[model samples]
Target: MAKSDSVTRSAVLHRDTRFVPKKAVGGKGSYIFLEDGTKFLDSTGGAAVSCLGHGHEEVSQAVINQINQISYCHTAFFGTEASEELARLLTESTGGKLSKLFVVSSGSEAVEAALKLARQYFLELPTPQPQRTRFIARKPSYHGVTLGALSVGGHMIRRQPFEPLLSSNTSHVSPCYPYRGKKAGESDADYVNRLAEELDGEFQRVGPDNVCAFIAEPVVGAALGAVAAVPGYFPAMKAICEKYGALFILDEVMSGMGRCGTLHVWEQEGIVPDLQTIGKGLGGGYAPVSGLLIGEKVVEVMDRGTGVFRHGQTYQGHPVACAAALAVQKIIQRDNLLENVRKMGAYLEERLRGCLGDHPNVGDIRGRGLFWGIEFVKDRESKEPFSPETGVAFQVQETGLDPSHGISLYASNGTVDCTKGDHVLLAPPYNVTKEEIDIIVDTAGRVIEAVFAKVNAA
Candidate 1:
């Protein structure tokens, strides 16, 4: 169906006001069809949410059946079976390490809940320390958009306008970014220890007794383009948090739920967070859902207290959302999709490197599992990023979206700071085929080449 000129003038507020985006009429498997009949291979899974892909029959049926049974039920009054089952599945997947779940409607909400829980956990202690109010987070990290989550998030561009409203209780340390943070002669061990020391110094500067938690993304997502830490990075950071009596919080909204081949990204890191937040692939884009996974320690504190979380949202545990997520998880287990993620993830890394490893402008290609990122620089040897005025990543994304290219990639900036770097992320569905992977890499190669060619011409 072709969209009329009138329809192009959408009533809904879009991300960009300068140009209206093409309307997507439908989607199936790994492709989204536009109103103009253009088909795009969804390489980034719409910001890595569509893990199971579009039009999954089982997930759709689960949502419909849930709506028919009971769509909405306030948690204050009662709990639904869908929420209970989903929570049980999630907790069991963690081997009871994260013993409880607080389902929410979005990743931001999950982060918000985790932050509140951290504060409340301290207050509930036998000798409550009201001074434990500060939070330490890493720079170039993204937690969420909600005020509290945004406060802890280190994305300066997103935080600048809202700085006045953000809490001053939060402080940021340098991220574990090897591409930029590591010195030329430094060993991985040395780099990790240096970062750990920085975090420890922040705790001291802020008065360790005044801090509640130290939060970070196990694998930095869009903000840093899937940058994972060095071998001992997480364990060292967790040790610092432990030393300071601060809870360790991991925001896996983009990296968890089998997106990185494991049920939880932290599983591969060898550390269990005191509070963990998961979203994106949880419902496989079938519904809006995210969750806060509470560890045994936090649960013990709550149990010893009033046994009630002070936060509540009307859709805190919507039946339809929980049902959709449960179905998505079940399919992942039944189909052994995580195994596919590992196999295909290795293939993707190999293909990306083989395709553009030596491109003069392609500075780095880093990722694990099915998630990957390609950073573009003006000079590869120096790792000098293209000027922000160039908008290299956004140009690549737009070029990929062109009907001729027919690909959709995720674009991000500020990998060097809050304003300097440009990178594109590719996160195809977990069940993507080898052939599709080939097409993704090939198309991405062409898109990047074409965009940079234009840049050179300009």
Candidate 2:
């Protein structure tokens, strides 16, 4: 085992000051190896980032080649072929609906760019509505961590500490989390209509003419734990945005780039977004890359105005990052991994339900493709979440990593509200096999059972 004392004495400012994490020396495919030579099945893909898994030779070679050719070029001065190719592939994936791409280093930066572009789109219009400065997003949603992105995000616990510092121009409504948000006996259509009316009311309250955009995740991640909207929900919300002349923005940072079986989650939904943000799976953890995909309307407005987006980043289009992402995308297509994601996703869901469906604490199992969440509750019928102090999700995650389990799962709390619910997410690599899916489901069941047993014993 690795010694904590030796690892704690480091200059790196880690996420937790009280504890130092284990060192992962290497990884390949679905498993990561620690310095102690212990292996862990990467069930959550490192928070759903490593879609292609680790040590991909193709991606590594792409990065090496790009670095050998040209590593860095300021976007203002020169553009690189790597960046152009990556952008072309991404735009093409969207069927040219998103005609422009603004590549950035992280999901947070992509969100910040999207917010800025939304504001800029209005300013560039022939009859500019400078007053259209407010944004409406859904609660229990996460965009990113930067100030502007955080302002637009609706994850309450994440925003509480930064409340005073966040922008007041943003407002939030109920997310399309049917598991919890749907009223007893309410039909899906009624639930969607209610949420749509709520969004419309928010726009009216903020002055419809003053709203710039309505941003949402097609499938809510992190805060809500893989909660997908009910049928017709996106279309209803899009109608409200269109009625108010507001840009429809989809934050696909965690759900896009084939995470949801489809290349774009919006493709499943009937309507198209005016602005979109994608990351996490974009480079499949090969490099830190994310981007804002601008719709034709937004691009046209900018083209007719200044022909330039009033934003800049030093690493806006890093050649190495672009090259790695391009290679990852090519590998995904060449291997036909999305088909595997669908087949395995169905098997995983079936196995999870078969194993844990009747567990007393298992509240809801929901998700699509490789992204799935298992929410826990104090009482399944009541949907009563465990108190935040219980730390149920975290405990399950820790248990999964125990030597006996040798698995890694993504733990998240605040599923019921800002601090009351617990959930563990599973997002194995897109190419995970049936045997691996069985192991993941079996290990997950064991982890959940062990954690709850301890809670009961205590």
Candidate 3:
């Protein structure tokens, strides 16, 4: 057995059965330090969670203050000040339409609450359609890992093992992936319309009246590597949901909170969801926090139908998490960080193009704001992905973490249709400097080239 494996086997059940991660001893700004004092630039923000990066004195101070006041409180009995203030700020920014905020400890919990709230909204309908039990989602999408979130997620590999336990009421259609899915002769408009048609067909097949909600990531995260939908896709989707009287749930857990250069990605797409799940950068990784932002349309239905939304968690609206998130958000707004995201995002894109635009194995480079993805293909013309068994992306990631490079990233295999391609994801903190951005892209380019060369030689 490997040393890491032996160590983990004696202590815990880690995600990878064969490997154990090194202990993270400390962190500052946009880098994390390992036990051996080797530091890695946190390019992926620990899966796009650390927006403010690590070691923010302000966020840390806020958490400390909240804990001193009251860390835990039974939401069943009394709501805390921090939770109230955070909800007020969120609702205010959302223009009051997103009035109710249901806080949770993690993205999955928020998603679970969102799903239950959706189901409960239907229950409150005076003459609710009994057949409204199905859900419409898109493939190459990820919501979360809990049962409810997993039910809505369309990631084939993640859902495969739990297929038996997952709800059969869910249906997945093609994502609005323009790079690979769009035909050579088709225009962007036509490609979008085709995807809309596919979604419509799925809804019809599932029986429009039976579909409760259509859940999607405004910009697909994790699964497709920051794959934003084709222009006009979301408007078309929202219209369809409206026509069918179905709710729309946008899972912005990874793409929202300024990661996509906006407070909410749907704002950029010119659409609003009936319910939204947000996390990751919500608390800037200072504390565990996630939330369900309910739209006025859904609120109205619930208000008219039933007086109460039936769902609650013990740790819902924890004071310390709220305080930390509140402080983090205030800093974002107070500092006008969105403007920086727009400026830095363009710079990052240009640097990436300059560095890796013509690499032989690089298939596509795409993303928005600070989130970016580099896909690799064996045959560029055919966009043929490397075999999954090769694990090319994982190797590149491991090489990037070498002491000489000292860059960390989000990497994955099976990007092509969830079982064939490799991709390296970069989601540096929003507060990252131009120099840091250059270092991240340059290091990533070098590491990717090295891995590609090795693979080709083999």
Candidate number of the best lDDT: 1
Question: Once superposed on the true structure, which residue ranges of model 3 sit more than 4 Å away at CA?
Answer: 1-10
lDDT of 3 by residue, 118-208 (tens): 8878877778766788888888788888987898888889899998999888899988888888998998889888888888888889889
In model 3, pairs of residues that clash are: none
Residue 71 of model 3: what lDDT? 83
Tell me how candidate 2 scores on lDDT. 0.90
Q: What overall lDDT, based on C-alpha atoms, would model 3 receive against the true structure? A: 0.87
Better candidate by TM-score, 2 or 3: 2
Q: Write the per-residue lDDT of candidate 2 for residues 67-127, one digit (tens) a residue.
A: 9999998999999999899999989988899998889999999999999999998999999
lDDT of each: 0.92, 0.90, 0.87
Mark the regions of model 2 whose C-alpha exceeds 4 Å error after superposition.
1-3
Question: What ranking of all candidate models by lDDT puts the best one first?
Answer: 1, 2, 3
Candidate 3 shows a clash count of: 0
Q: How far is candidate 2 from the true structure (C-alpha RMSD, Å)?
A: 1.3
